[model samples]
Target: MNRIREIFDIGAGFENIIEWLTEEADWLFDFIALVVEGFLEGVNWLFHFPPALVMIGLFSLLAWRVAGKGVALFTLIGFLLILYMGYWSETMDTLSLVFSAVIFGLLIGLPLGIWASRSDSAWKIMRPVLDFMQTLPAFVYLIPAVLLFKLGPVPGVIATLIFSLPPVVRLTNLGIRQVPLEIREACRAFGATPKQMLIKAEIPVALPTIMAGVNQTIMLALSMVVISGMIGAGGLGNVVLKGITQLKIDMGFEGGICIVILAIFLDRVTQAFTTKDKS
Candidate 1:
């Protein structure tokens, strides 16, 4: 049994191949880093552009409009708590990271999902890939991400994007597939072009499901953003990490409460959007 296991041991070979690729792929990594950095910078600037107070006011108003008074109150309290805890900047940084990941994830995943919906072969190919992405331990994404982009928000964003992408694609595909065949046929009978059918009939109906997917993507991105801080992503996660390193239980708890508050706020807002669309 030992001899047989030795014969099949490919770990060394895998390591060697990875080492070779890492050495040879410097240019690829550099290019990716440049693009990701640009995106991160842009999102960071957007999040920071308005004074924090103004941003908070706008967000609170949006919550009231979309999610109702209860959620708006919660949003106001949550932001205030984070600000009072002196983690406002870190919270903003985390938000920027999550938003950037969602933006990129949607840009790529939505098109792929739509394509898969239209082609059986494409769906077949995408299924296993999405399964692999979704089923893989989230931490595994950071390994290659760190290798490629090194430590910082770049790698963090890359990891978050990869980790959060599968849900959007899968949901988008499911949404389109779930559309009633009768509706499709009626559109065809009405002489609707494929583009027109999709834009007019299919997408409108699928919007709720797609938005649910977007919500999931955002949540997953937020979770990954926190974990990515282990690699120096620098956000509320960093504060939490610092608390852990220093054995500051109160600090850790404070950071954790802030994270939970933010999560609830985002979850409520997205869910509200989904519910509103459905209604």
Candidate 2:
């Protein structure tokens, strides 16, 4: 009883700070949500549909461009797995949710990372916040996401975005920082502007590392999709969640296997793209 009271007292002691931070975060989340909603509406107006067929076609082209015959076939097999499993709609929902999260994470992370790489003070300021974000447990993020975003794919997307954003930020910062001092000096000698240095020197050298960060971000986001389904994010995850609630072993098992298959396929494709060949 005494310990419980002490914990409550401690929490009460920080109530003002907590409340202020919460309010600030709420405003930020609302602003971001509005921006995303606008972008999504614009996309819907242009695409007029889910664009899965477009994605499949693009993936095929990408596979041919990257890994040739074997990878293209693998891409087809992955598509068929979702189709045969009767989870096309669910998969599309998951894709949309993951895509939104990844795009937002990149948009925010890459620029912040580039800026941080430019100054030691900036890196010191941002590093611990990212460390805290990366260290926090997955489920903990979902609580505020649900409270603020109100339980659906939107909240799930926000949670997944927060959960997955750290890697890209950290890696992007590292990648840019690791650019050789001599190369930067050479660029400077050529009278290149900061913008030109970044575009011509930094990003190209950093591309592999940035792609690796993206790969990690995507995998983490996919992992979160199933957990997010608890609050209305739909995918093979919802199938697994249903199986658990109803004690349907086959459904759970099959869904689990499908997730594994999808993960493998994505990892392979992304890795193929990242692993540049030197002749």
Q: What are the lDDT scores of the predictions, listed in order?
A: 0.90, 0.79
lDDT of 2 by residue, 48-128 (tens): 364656666776677878767887887777777766777766666666677778888899989888988898999999999
In the predicted model 1, the residue pairs found to clash are none
lDDT of 1 by residue, 1-279 (tens): 889767776775656666776899888879888988899999899888888788889889999999999999989988988888888889999999999889989999999988988999999999999899988898888877777788999999989998999888988899999999999999999999999999999888998999999999999999999999899999988989998999999989998998899899899999998999998
**Stretches of candidate 1 above 4 Å error?**
1-17
User: What is the Cα-based lDDT of residue 18 in candidate 1?
Assistant: 63
Which model scores highest in lDDT? 1
Clashes of 1: 0
Clash pairs detected, candidate 2: none
Clash totals in order: 0, 0
The TM-score between candidate 1 and the true structure equals 0.94
